[model samples]
Target: MHNEVRSVDGGSSLVQAQYIGTVNQQLPGPERVVPHETPRALRRLVGRNEQIEACLADQRVPLVVFDGLTGVGRRALARYVAEQVKDRYPGGAYYTDYATHTVDGESVISAALRSLLRRDGVRDEVMPAEPGLASLWRRRSSGAAAVLLLENVTESEQFLQLMPGGRDWLVLVAGRVESRLEVREVGGETIPVEPLDDEQAAELFRELSGLDADPDDPVVAEILGYCGGLPLALRNAATLVVVGRCPSLPELAARLRRSRAELMRSDRGPNKGNPVFEATYQEATEPAQRAYRLLGAYPAIDFTPPVFDLLIGLDEATSRDILAELVLLKVLQEEHGRYSMHPLVHDHAASLSGLDDEETHEALARVVRGFRNAAYYADAAMIGVERYRVADAPEIADPFSGDRRANGLAWFEENRRALHELLPVAEKIGLVDEIWQIAESLAAYYFDRKRQADSLSSLRHGIKAAEEAGNRAAEARLRSLASRPLTDLEQFEQAGDFVRRSIELADQDGHLVLRASVREFAGRYHDLTDQPELAQQRYRESIELNEAAGEARGEALSRMFLGQSLGDAEGLRELETAHRAFGELGDSRSAARALLITGQVRVRTGLPGGVDALTAAAEAFQTSGATFYEAQAREALHGALVVENPVEARSHLDRAIQLYRELGSPRAEKLASENDGGLDGAES
Candidate 1:
């Protein structure tokens, strides 16, 4: 009487039914449990020679579960073993699909009773309504050995409930989800069915379709490799060979290659029962097919719900549901809250989405734009330098509002791999602006982490893209970003080369800001190489251009560097101007640097003492994670403290000397050592 079936959590089930019958009538035909269909000819198939021998061994629970990915022939092997073990069960064998059954935790007892009663040839007239179905099913199976074939089961709840209280019956459960099932005593056994080994695959291939020679033969191996160790693919590829459609082994390989190639071109195709993957896709519904195709729109392997919602035109819940279905079908995979499809399947999905070359480019462009925007917002927050900015910006609906840094960092980290792969494609498609924008956005993350190589590679590609696009302004800007990493790597000559090109490009394009910025880098290069005169000249030029262009911030930076070249006292003269300009731009770090510079000048001239100025500088540098500058300030502070007390002086001097030496700044280290020696001499 109780046949109303529903999912335990009110979620949609693949099948649902509500019963209205009150008599508890034992229906004869339709209500009986339907057995899983097994391929007929595979029952006594040759070449499971080892498995047949294994099943003949004495074991209490002689059941073996065959499990594999979609289209790998788990059912075929299971049926073959079932046929061989038929003589062991005196009461005959029963085949049923536990996968499609909706028997709840409470109803499993009844469902098992009905299934057992139907097999026991008991009529409804003698069966009682009460004492429950579990009691009735157990009584019917009394004093007999029963064998059951349970197919496509994913959960173990139903199986555990129906397992005969005694150990007389042998039960075999097969499905793709074996990870959830745990076996215990009463002669527990577990066997995982994997793709056939190459040799076994070859044997199955020859025995089933007459492709007999050594499979290790180069040509045969080539064909088997195309099958991807799946029995269904091998069977289909063999069928193609036997029918003279693709006769030679090489031709069959070609056919599979062609099939895969085509799978990548369209989203849907005839499941030819041969190419394994095509047949699997043929089994999906329209919604599942759409889900499969839409997954291709996500270029990164770890795609979140927000991205899927944005690009796939589906709501969060709907997308998750569809993705779940695809996961069950082996068309998609869910890992750590993100989704991914296999490369082969991804290509097919991309092809089938009806996107032309131009549209694909456009879609990729949108994704890149979103990524770049996130990167830009992160960079703008971290550093005040606005390397690149797009006009007519879209509104940002940030999900992780409380912590923008962590969220942006995570997004960049997740997509970093995919972004690297997409760079070449963007360049090939002539999206130069996009190329530079993405690089510029990631610059802060790379620079802050001291990933010199990554920064250089990104900027180099960005510069190349800009040059190819004939964008002189962008080229100049990219070259400036590129120079920092080159300098870090001590490729001074290359760094200087980029600075020169940026200057030329900026001047040619009349991009005054870029021209001013490039000149600042040139000045830095000159200073690093000990060409003070040349450094002063470049800094002066940058100052003049920045002033003329009304870029107060740029003007301030150039003048600050110029003052530093002149010496500590002179550097303080320009600090107030630099501070005012940086303040106007709301750049806390630059303003802080200017203040620190002013403090250093005061200390050098014995006005406020070097310790005070250096302490302020250190604090600013620490706040910004400016390790290099912070170390420099610490070194200066150590020098100032050298004269205060001998013990403290030696401690500061020794530490400063070591840090400078570790940084590979010989000039800085030599000065620190000189101070240390002077302190030692005085102390002695």
Candidate 2:
């Protein structure tokens, strides 16, 4: 049932029809589909061996411009080099295609400004609507240390604007037209990609089409000559040959000449192929053209199902068919369920669309906002936000302004990866308010699930973006957000610095919510660093702030943490206070967590009620959807039960141990194991 359509043979003069294996044969489905766009390894592409040696030997290339003609594969070579020397540019990595030098033929700078914005992934800062876009682009790229690929550029101003930025950035410009671009701040050597010599052209043809295709044949030489050593031309020719359309190279040359004429006469009929692209693009329907241009608006390599609905105005089947056709024509590449235009093809399509820059921006913004909306709902469920639904609702939930605390915890777990992906786009678009909301939602998931790596990555980036955007509330939240993982990793000094920053930001912004959150996180950090008195002081302060803000849930959480820390500090009186606060919040999971900590406190003091508290907590946690807490609570209850009731103790301990083992939690297992051994020893 494989639905793969292989290229037609080069030897055939006629366009070889697609082979339908059998009329009754089933179609290839999702299970049979192979992955399409696995990023090729860096070693596989060109010009990188020298760059690698230079980077490794610490030689300075201050600026190396890889400049060339359109579709000459210069950008690909640059990308390969970037991949190779990524370690050298550790500050960051930036890629931009400068192909669209005309936004309604306004200014090359405006076109480049849009690309630069796309490159940095910067959003949310108030920017001028139009005209002076280049000034803004120049300002943003000047400071970063990264690599910039200036693709398909024409004017010197594009390079001049970017020259002031990216101290360590390597700028590679690719296109048919060169700017003779020069800068005073940095001297760069240009590596011009000349038209391939006959030998190289022949080699390219052989690689694309095979050696079996007669090299001595005049037809082969004819097609190669027509292509004029252009890599793009060679690629398209090879595709035609594989489909068995132009059997002989001479025939390809003849057909291409005919295509050129047809393209020139396009005003005569309307559907004739583009003169520049030859006749290949003319074969596409208007709907396909619309789809091609619309798909280019999404920044990410992949698109969700909803993208088809939003961007292209066709039904799913029709859109998928058009997309598949474009991929066949080599204008688009399909990967998973998503599609992307080759960067050059993307430029061509954009130029053809006639849509102005503002229109393009508006369309792109809508798509990104839609993506954010979907991911937000998913994340909301994972963090115990219950009110948000998967379908159409009256109001869109705002992570920052909305009552996110009211949503049930499930939102965070369901949309964790989606939320993670949304972070960069959210920041780039200057959605500062959204960034803060995401940080809060993610904080709960990161701590509860122990996703330390992701927590650090997401929070740190958000913090920087928030600070840059001057969103005081977001800055304050991220200050606390950055502390948790460092504390977990035993980086105490760094953890304390983050907490202090959070406090400073909160105080400057006068955000009581952020202030309270920081106080609680500081308590956690202090306890991790073995400063119990400081931890106790921070915990009480967090509780007081939450109470003053009238934030019942925050107050409850702070009370729970205070009790746990004090209980760990061997203060039993705080357990009753923690229990009361948690009960007020009506959070079964937190209440259960409180009970487990209380039981541990009681166990240290040899209190008679330890087993009862643990048993009750285990029951509550089991229904709260967390396997880890349930197992721990059960183990605690089993330990207390072991001293008085062996049968009941063994029953609970066995299940607890099995559950803990399944969850890969060694601490919970140890507790269950010790209780089991004690009961068995008592019986013996």
Candidate 3:
């Protein structure tokens, strides 16, 4: 979640209005095995119910333009609205801030398309031109459903190009407007978000500051006057009182008066924080100020305590404590253990911290180092065929420790968006090495989620970086990594070419581990292309090379894939051996794959434990967050059960088809076609 401070709407009805919310949900490329909770619920949205209800009522409208003053809760309103109706968009509700950073050269349409395609699980390498990406979004969304909250869009032309070209999906565009003209030009119904009325402001202050003052109290009115009733300033004023910087609300009000008196017209302009941020900044403790400014350098999204540790280079305990203090001050909001700063607050902090370029640069380096290490370790845990492992990196605390819901796969899924955002940030600072490392580390998650496009995108970056760094071994490995996704995408010729190039590079560099790994992809391409003989030969060569390199995981997987594609008694022997290797290595996904293949072979031989083996494989895949593989295991079971138990087989096939369709895999067509109008061919 980008910003999480929604204000009360005082129950004003909307003729037409749309609010922008930042996207916080990760793709299945991010969702992983299961979601542990619902979207974070609102604490209290004052003065915003009518606007929300009106937007919900006008479902056919498809687009709503939320025009409001800065700090008046536009992002908050959008977030509130998304939470209210997310169920309607089964594809998921997403938030993105297209507030255009300095080096973001893409057109507004390109940015919008990127957001939409990313939501649809299309990674950047496969990302098409604007029109085509939008077309892909239209086709995908029309069939399923989606919601996008686009924040910081300044013109009608921006959102106009992003409209679904149909009415099935909903988009809310939020921005500050000098007039309703832009909103009118976009043809969206406009919802103007006003500041809180007296009653709401009083309630908000008491809630935030622990103040007992009533609505009619002179002190309360005086404070609200300086805040202009904007939730941003009002909350900052209340924070001053709550944090003991002011002895009372009256003192806070007086301080605000002095700050506004000192402000130049330029400093008090509309884009400004109305002198409130200045007063709050002046009053905050030194540590709090430093934490706030450092927080601005973090990504524009929800983050965890460990991220703070990365941002400020503080120990985890101190970093977490600082964040907790900010939460109490209403400068940050905590939801289900993740904390987010309102954009206005982040902007305010960012504006003040322009004096420390060197420290800021080092802080950013810490962030890169942290992400690179996390991605490396997380990938290691998820997949076992280790071509390499990052050695001797600093031990960083797991950011997802607060939730207790993550293993390797779940961790990758959770941080997918954050990692994506960090790629550009690393590039901007010339952390070229970190950029490719992070991208390569995330390859396993993208592969399992069937996000071939995303995998290819990351691999391309790694390849470019390796070439630039003149690291032939890394270039070969990246080429091998790049081909796996191409194989998945069924671009067999393209995949094989990469494999061939990788082999040449590995041979030139005498990289044995690299050669072994690239050969596995080569074998897979042959296997997928129905040349089982060629696949078997390639797998044998891979196994020989891996054995020479002493890579147990690679050797085991080569045997598993070769045996599975062969479908003979000898194959079963190989699978059993591979399964034992994976299980002993604690690599659950590969273990599951081996078991699934062995189970199918067992069923062919009329063995009693065929279903049991497949069952265990499914369970393993589920626990490890290999959802697509889980579905594949289920499909194999369906095939095995078709002869002995038609009813069970139908159920299994139904589930497999459902998952395949959801993932948009071509396997769904084959599975559905094989079912052929209700299992009419079942029985021996």
Candidate 4:
């Protein structure tokens, strides 16, 4: 019996069996091969008209390969061509990314086949195994006129495995220029996709930037030249302009000229830099090549110039020159004076056979140590010197020299992701001391920013490392720090347990400041759990311990908490004293917290000047990057003003909602829901 094929909507084909002879058995037709939708193409194609026309010039060619340097827009061009000719193949256009789908350098042809078959109504249990996938695919797709767009194809064999057996089928492959020879042997026509021309690059930049300027303008010309006619570079440059990073064309041009590196490096979409970067690295200067290899092994996502110098073991000027050269080569990307490699480029650089194991390990160790030292300095500058800190601040030149507190907090905020990335790397290399110490340094920043989840995760890791190294003081500090995030996350039982353990550890270790800190956390846990009397007792104990240890900051902080628990005239007096002490100690952030609590209590009790106090506190928190507290102050101000001035109250609520949303706080949604349908019709 033979089957007659019928095309259906959505690129599926049905079959009807035609039986002959005496036997009257009707066999089921082949399963419908439901075509996967083609990958989304760029909203607009730029400077690929010639390539598109060539690909479509001969409709009879079954295979077409668009090969070029990475980020030259090969994938985008192929996607555009496939979309344009989609109607020619009724079986529909199917798409898959080979780079994403492959496993351990082997093409996962079975996954591709299974995806196609499953979508075509094939049941999972009835599906064929790996060896049978290609046979089934060919059998099912025999008469189906379809288009296949295989992106980032690395080998010709991958193409052969997925190729349909029909003469009418068209396969469009996109990969690096090196893949052209292998694909050509399989009758695939190679189309070399070059960088955009000057005019096209200029148009793309103008379109993306939403800027209207003469093409001959000096700044515009400088940008175009720096982009080197690459669409990826042009898009990123335009992004920098649109985001107000450079503010104007001239500023962007000057930045480009000064750094000789693309400021805005994006790894979005199919812009992998590995293929072209490998060749670029091979041709770069020895110093630039060494920088690339070492940087690839660097754990952090990005680094400043000083850190770069340390990592490369070079002097300041020499390292800067090497960085400029690598940036000019497009191997390293620099953004706002910090240098980093694209993840794909980093992977390639790391894979290169340059540094031996010991050299790489030592280089990475130096970078980690540099970060640790800087973190300790920033921590001290931002929060004052905490006696509970296990690691001493190394006697290095201070990185944050001016406006120490502001700059320290700013540095932590800027490198937060890099700091988080370094933890596992440090742990892997047995830098246990560094791991706990870095986590300890980040605790205050984390708490002020309301990154409770991150705080909890980092503290847990630090606690583990401290315990592993048998460092009781570090373990005690980390455990006490864990309570804050746990309490904020509403894991009250866990928070209380951590507080108890921390108190015990501090006593056993015989550290007065550590014991004071743990006592304050215990008081916080009690307050959160609504045991005001017990909370006050813990706070009083903490105050005595801090005073005994001559730690005025800890004593003042505990007094602030004690005042909050009191919630009366005496409580107000305590808050006033704590605020004054913090101001005298030059700890403005802690002063602001004390003022915030006082304002909150006054607002709740309908006291005068509550709004004024909240407004001042909010401003301070905003200035200090204490985003969570700022939101709290805003919420308090809204509550205080809602009855008397609904319009102003709504404004405060709006700002609070925005800040909470930015911080990923659930309070954002809660406030939004509570205020929904126009707060007292004031919004209308």
Q: What ranking of all candidate models by TM-score puts the best one first?
A: 4, 1, 3, 2
Higher-TM-score candidate of 1 and 3: 1
Model 4 Cα lDDT, one tens digit per residue, 456-480: 8888889989999999889988998
lDDT of each: 0.63, 0.59, 0.70, 0.78
Could you estimate the TM-score for every candidate? 0.57, 0.48, 0.55, 0.60
lDDT measured at residue 476 in model 3 versus the true structure, 0 to 100: 81
Query: Which digits, one per residue and each the tens of the lDDT, describe model 3 over residues 588-618?
Result: 6678888887777777677778789988987
Candidate closest to the true structure, highest TM-score: 4
Candidate 1 local lDDT, 1-684, one digit each (tens): 344555666686544445544666555644333333332426454345665566557777734555446555556666777776666767567776653444766354455556666565666665666356656666655546767676655545445545664456777666554243455433545564555778878887787567664776987887766665666666666677777987777777777766654322221134232333554566677777755665565555556666565554656788677767667666666678877665556655655664445555565666666666666666655554343332223367533455454555566667667666567666766777778877777777776555678778888888888778777777787787778888878998889888888888888887677777888878877776788899899998989888888887778888777766665566667776787888788776677667666656666667764466567766776666555556566656666666676677566456556554554555455765466532110000
- Report each candidate's C-alpha RMSD, comma-separated, in the order given: 14.3, 26.1, 27.0, 22.4
For each of the candidates, give the backbone clash count: 2, 41, 14, 0
Best-fitting candidate, scored by lDDT? 4
Candidate 4, 591: how far from true, in Å? 2.3
- The candidate, 1 or 2, that scores higher on lDDT is 1
- Score candidate 2 by lDDT: 0.59
